[model samples]
Target chain A: MLIGACLFAAGLYMVLTKSNAIQVLIGIEFIINAGVINLVAFGKYDRYHNSGQIFALFAIVLAAAATAVALAIILNVYRRFKTIDPGKIDELKD
Target chain B: MEQGIFIFLGLTTVASAWFVAASQNLVRSVFMFFVTLFAVAGLYVFALADFVAVTQIVIYVGGVLVLMLFTFMLSSKETLEKLEESRHPVFTLKQFPALLVAAAFLIVLVNAIFKLKPDQLGWILQATNNTFRPQDNTVTNIGTNLMTTFLLPFEAISILLMMALIGAAHLARKERSFD
Candidate 1:
C-alpha cells in the first residue's frame, strides 16, 4: 500500500541520515511496521488460513526482541565511547 | 462510512512517523514514535485484525515504548534544554546518498500504485473483504492454527524470544576485569 511505502521511505531515510544509534533502531522499527501493514492488508483476502495475519504477528514479536538486543548493543557502545553517535565510533577497538 | 476513520488514522500515522524521522531531540523522537505506533494500531483494527491490533498495543506501545523511554531517561540527563540541544540535523555527507535512493524508491512505489489499481492486475494483491465470512471469531481461529498447523513456528518463536532476552542481558552486563 502507499502508506506502507511512504513509511518505508521515511524509515530508510532516517537510518541513512541519522548518526545516532538509537535513531537507527527507530528507523528499523519503522521498516518492520511497514512490512506488518502490508501483511495484514493481504490477510484480509485470505478467508481460509489467514497466513498474512499470522506472519504479521510473528514479525511484530520478532521486531520487539530485535529492538531489545539492539538497545543492549547500543548501551555497550555508549559505555566504550561515551557517545551514542555511530559516526564517531568507527573502529571495533576500544 | 469507515473511510472517515481510516483517513484520519492514515494521516495521523504518517504525520507522526514523519516527525519521528525529522525531530532533533532524542526524547521528542521517542515520544513521537509512541504516537506513530498507536496510530498504526488503530489502522490494524480498521484492517479487521482485531487480535493483531491488541497485540500491537500491548507489546509495541506498552512494552517496547516503555523500554525506549527508560533507555532515553537513563542514558541522558533529562532537561528541556537537553532535549533541544541533542537534536541532530536531518542530513549530512553520510546520509545524502541514502536520501536520494529512498526518495527514488518512494516515487517508484507511488507510481506503481497509481498505475495498477485493483482491476488492472495490481502490482500487489490485497483482500479488502472480511476473511472469516462464516465465523468472525478471529482469535479462536488463530489459537487453533497456532496449536495445530503452525505449531512448530509458534514454538520456535518463543525459543527465539527467550534467547534474545538472555543475549541482551549478557551484552548489557558489566565486564569483570582482573586488576
Candidate 2:
C-alpha cells in the first residue's frame, strides 16, 4: 500500500512536470501500475475469488489499449503541428 | 526471506519509478519506466499474483514499452533535438508547485491507508478464516472463473480491444489531406 502511494506520487509529479505528451502517457502508466499493485495486494487475502487479480488483468489490457490510441493520437498531432510538446500544441486554444 | 524479498521488490519498484519521473532524457526515462514495470511485476509475484505478474511482463513490457519506443523514434527529429537541448537540473524552482501537489497527495493517501486498516475488514477476516487456503495454482481458478462468471466482461474487453485497434490504425495513417 505504501509502495502504491509512493508510485502514485511519483507519477503525478511526472505528469505535471513533463511537457512531452508521451512522457505524460508514461506517467499515466505509472499511476495505473500503482493502482494494480494495490488491487493485487488486497486480492491476496481473497484466495477463492481472486477478483483483484482478474481486475488487474483487465486494467492492464485497458491501459495498453489506451496507450495505443493515445500514442497514435500523439503521432498524428506531431505530424500536424511539428511538435509533441503539450504546451506548444495550442492551435485548438486559439 | 520472503519478507526481505518483498521489501527489496518494493524498493526496486519505487526507486525505478522515481527515476522514471525524474530523468530528463526522454529515451532514458522510458527505459527507466521499463525497469519500474519489471519491478512492479516482481512486486506482483510477492503478492502471490503470478498470473498478473506474467501479464505485466508480456503486455506492459513487451507490447506497451515497445510501442512507446517506436513512437519516440517516429516523432519529429527537430522536436527530439529541441527537447534534448532544453535540459534542466532534476530540481528546479519551476517544478516546486508540482512537487508540492504530489507530496500533499502522498500524505493524504498514507494517512488514509493507516486509518482504514483493510486487513481488519469483515469480509477479509471471514474469507481468511473460511476458504483462505493458499494454493499454488491460481491459473486454473482464474481460467474457470473467466469462463464462467466473467464471460461477459471477457467478451466485452475483446470487442473493446478490436475497436481500439481499428481506431488507432485509422487515426495514425497518413492524412488524406497531406497527399
Indicate which candidate wins on DockQ: 2
lDDT of 1 by residue, B1-179 (tens): 78998998898888888888887777788889988898888888877788999999999988887887777666756343554675556666666799899899899988987886734443233444535443487888788887888888899999999999999999988886512
lDDT of 2 by residue, A1-94 (tens): 9999999999999999898999999999989988999998888876666688888999999999999999999998888888888988877732
* Candidate 1 CAPRI classification by DockQ: medium
Q: Write the per-residue lDDT of candidate 1 for residues A1-94, one digit (tens) a residue.
A: 7889889998998898776788889999999999999898777667557788898999999999999998888877776776777788878753
Which regions of candidate 1 are displaced past 4 Å?
A: B78-83, B86-95, B118-130, B133-135
Q: What DockQ results do all the predictions give, each relative to the true complex?
A: 0.64, 0.77
Question: Model 2 over residues B55-102: C-alpha lDDT tens digits?
Answer: 999999999999999998988687788898999899899899999999
Name model 2 segments beyond 4 Å from true.
B129-134
